[model samples]
Target: MEKAIFAMIASAVVGVFVYPKFIEFLESKGSKQEVNEFAPDAFKEKKKTVTFGGAVFVAVPIIVMVILNGFTLNRDLFLLIMVYGSYALIGFVDDYKIVTEGKNDGISAKTKMAAQLGLSVVFYAVYILTGGDNMLSIPFLKTPINLGIFYLPLVMFMLSGASNAVNLTDGMDGLAGGTSLIAFIPFAYYAYKVGNFGVLLFILAIIGGLIAFLFFNRKPARIFMGDVGSLALGAALAAVAIVLGKEVILVVVAGVFVFETLCVIIQKISWKLRKKRIFRFTPIHYSFTLNGWDEADVVNMFYGIGLVCMVIGFVLLSLS
Candidate 1:
């Protein structure tokens, strides 16, 4: 408990203290964000903001953990950081391309997906090799249900799917970071209950870093987390779920992310299948802005929705 508390505060302090300097550095380099062509016009002005601020908060936990724990990680901690850091690396590359090329399309979709999938394979192998369970904890079941051979694909999907889910949700100020901060609450609780201190500490550290990041990332933002932060956070959540056998609960907690991704997918399918659209904007959050809602209202509403989902996730965990 002491270690966890220390980790959380330490990470938060590091991120809060480092962000202004980091943002200035990125601005000095003139590394501004790239607004997607499909994004809301209001967001086009976001192009003036510095990008890749994720590198600070995303690296905070790992750096703090190493300073305290001494460059050491058990299998579960290894898997957690490995997945988180590697996904961040991928996002770093993607962000690099976007910033340098001066466009929202960063690296080819095929290339990005390939990197995510390839890293999933490596993480899966580590899990299996480390004697992690091949079983999944099904809600309302007293015993875990074994996945056997199917676990591999499921794990791969959760990793990459979640990575993309959070990525898709990062379309606005404080949207992704705020929702993800709420989403990790249940995982942190359950991790403590299950005695997964390593996973628990990592989650708390993330939550802390997010709390500080959201301070700057809020409306009229000073910095954006960019792909590096979003991708890493999603993968980190999924990896913790895998470690704690809380995958099902993760879905409930990350409901906002799932919903956002579905909005995008549905928008795409609807557009292709019919000459129509369901919402004025795809992410559905931006669509809220279309209906006389401002960015702060949308973010606050989603934060409320995320809290509700967090409560529901706890209810589901109680069933187990």
Candidate 2:
């Protein structure tokens, strides 16, 4: 608990102090967000804002962890940092391309998927080799069900899905990062309960970093996290879920992310099958935007829903 509080305080302090400089640096470097052509009018106002500020949050935590906790070379800790850093790098490249080239289509979907797949495979192999379970824990059930060798594909799916889910949820200011901090609270507690201090410390650091980011990430944002922050956070969440044998509960706890992704999938399927669109826009948040809801309203409502899901996750965890 003390460690978690310290991590959070340190991260928030670093974020608060560093954010202004980071924004200045991005502007000086001519890094700005590209507004999608089809995006709502509200987004147009955010066009010139510097993005990928998530790097501040990501960097502060890792640097603090290494300096304060020291490197243990534990496989789980090593893999978590590696995967998180790798995804962040990919996101940074994507954001950089968009900012520099003035293209919203930063990287090819194929290339991104290939990179994600490679990372997922490595993560799964390392996990299994280190004697991690292939069985998944059912959310409301006490028993763990084995997936045999199918665990490889499952892990890939979880990682890819989580990354995209978080990416899709990044539409609003502080929406993704704020909700993620809330979601991580329980996971951090669970890690501590399980005596996984390394994972606990890592999570606490992330939570702290995000809290600091939120200072700038709030509505009418000064900077956006972009895909770089979103993807790394998603990967980190998946990795933690797998480590704690709580992947199944993730769907429920991260219901907002699931709903966002499902909305997109449904929109795509409906477009193909019926030549009709369901929501005014996919990801649901944009639907709220299309319906004339203010960005703050949408953010608050989504966060409320996230809090509810988190409470339910706590209940589920207790039952388990």
Candidate 3:
């Protein structure tokens, strides 16, 4: 508990203190954001803000952990950091392309998906080799569902989908950060309950870093986390879930992310099959904005719902 508290405090301090300097560095380097053309028109005001600010917060906790636990590096901690850091690297590349190219276009979708899949394979293989379970725990149930051979594909899908879900949820200021912060509370608790201090500390550190990022990323934001932050956060959440054997509960704790991804997927399938659109915007949060809710309101609503889901997930996990 002491270590966890220290990790959180150190990470939060790093995020809060380092972010200002990072933003100045980004601006000096001309690493500013370009609004996505497909984004809702209301977001035009955010153009040219410094981006990839998430990269700082993401690396801080990892560096802290490495310094603290270097001699005792465990498989779970190593895997968690490696998988998340690798995904952040991918997102960094995407952000670099967006900033330098002066457009939203990054790597091709196919290439990005391929990279995610390959990374997922490596993560799962390492997890299995390190004696992680092939069974999944279902919420509100006692028996573990064994996936046997199918666990590989399921793990890959969960990792990949988890990362993309946050990417889709990053459409609005404080949307992804707030939602993810709420989701991590219960996940960190779950890790603590399961005796996985490594995972617990890592998650608590992330929560702290996210809180600091939200300080700058709130309404009328001064900087953006870009794809780099979102993807890394999503991957970290997935890692926590996997380590705790509670991946299924993520669908509940991260309800907002699931909803946003579902909105996009449903919109895509409907448009391709029936030649029509579903919502005013695919993420559904922007749909709220389109329906007269302020961006702050949308972010608050997501935080509220996410807290409810997080609590429910905690209760269910406790019961099981």
- Per-residue lDDT over 15-59 for candidate 1, one digit per residue giving the tens place of the 0 to 100 score: 888888888899999888755445788777664788797787789
Residue pairs in candidate 1 whose N, alpha carbon or C atoms collide under 3 angstroms = none
Tens digit of lDDT per residue, candidate 3, span 242-295? 878888888888888898889889999999999999887877787887899887
- Look at candidate 3 and tell me the lDDT of residue 289: 77
Assess candidate 2 and give its TM-score to the true structure: 0.96
- In candidate 3, list every pair of residues with a backbone clash: none
Model 3, CA-based lDDT = 0.84
lDDT of 3 at 233: 86
Q: Give the runs in model 1 whose Cα sits over 4 Å from its true position.
A: none
lDDT (CA) per prediction: 0.86, 0.83, 0.84
Rank order by TM-score, top first? 1, 3, 2
Clashing pairs in 2: none
Find the 10 residues in a row with the least total lDDT in model 3. 33-42
lDDT, residue 164, candidate 3: 91
Position 242, candidate 2: lDDT: 87
Best by TM-score: 1
